[model samples]
Target: MKSTMANLWHLVKGVQIRDLGEKRYLFKFFHIIDMERVINGAPWTFNNHLLILHKLKGGEDPL
Candidate 1:
């Protein structure tokens, strides 16, 4: 999970880790992906999909 956060920190800005009590930390990261090429409502690309997976794995925030 640490590695995922690290990668996100490197790729995006405004990444934060928040303490939500009960020994829990929340990681938040934002990315802007263009979806003009989508035929239906699928607004995600392969890269974005991978990024979401990485974030969910509990990576450390580099920031």
Candidate 2:
């Protein structure tokens, strides 16, 4: 999933994907522009499964 998303975004600064349990994931972007681009292009999907995105605050649990 990580590799696939990284390829799809093609972010210059790259991103990190970490499993957050219960089918959730944390997408950590290395650059603000990269993050904004992704958020702006919302409603991303994988294998026909809808992906829900949420911007997390510092020290917040993404569950």
Candidate 3:
């Protein structure tokens, strides 16, 4: 498996934050110049879903 630093480097080189909204944030990642346009376009919504799933799975809160 790749180390965390390698993964982070890839992520950083490929991804960018586009916007932050009240309920969500937007992001984009580049893979191919014209063929692919990856758009997260809603970070907060994803985070909320993850939190809900974690709670349902009985994961301990880090707070």
TM-score of every candidate? 0.31, 0.88, 0.29
lDDT of 2 by residue, 1-63 (tens): 988988998898999888878988889899999999999998899989998888888898777
Candidate number that wins on lDDT, 2 or 3:
2
RMSD per model, one decimal: 11.0, 1.1, 13.5
* Better candidate by lDDT, 1 or 2: 2
For model 3, the local distance difference test gives 0.31
Best by lDDT: 2
In model 2, where is the ten-residue run with the lowest total lDDT? 54-63
Clashing pairs in 3: none
Model 1 lDDT tens row, 17-47:
5655664555455443211112122332343
Error of 1 at 24 (Å): 0.5
Off by over 4 Å in 1: 1-9, 32-63
What lDDT score is found at residue 16 in candidate 3? 44
Better of 1 and 2 by TM-score: 2
Ranking the candidates on TM-score from highest down gives 2, 1, 3
Ranking the candidates on lDDT from highest down gives 2, 1, 3
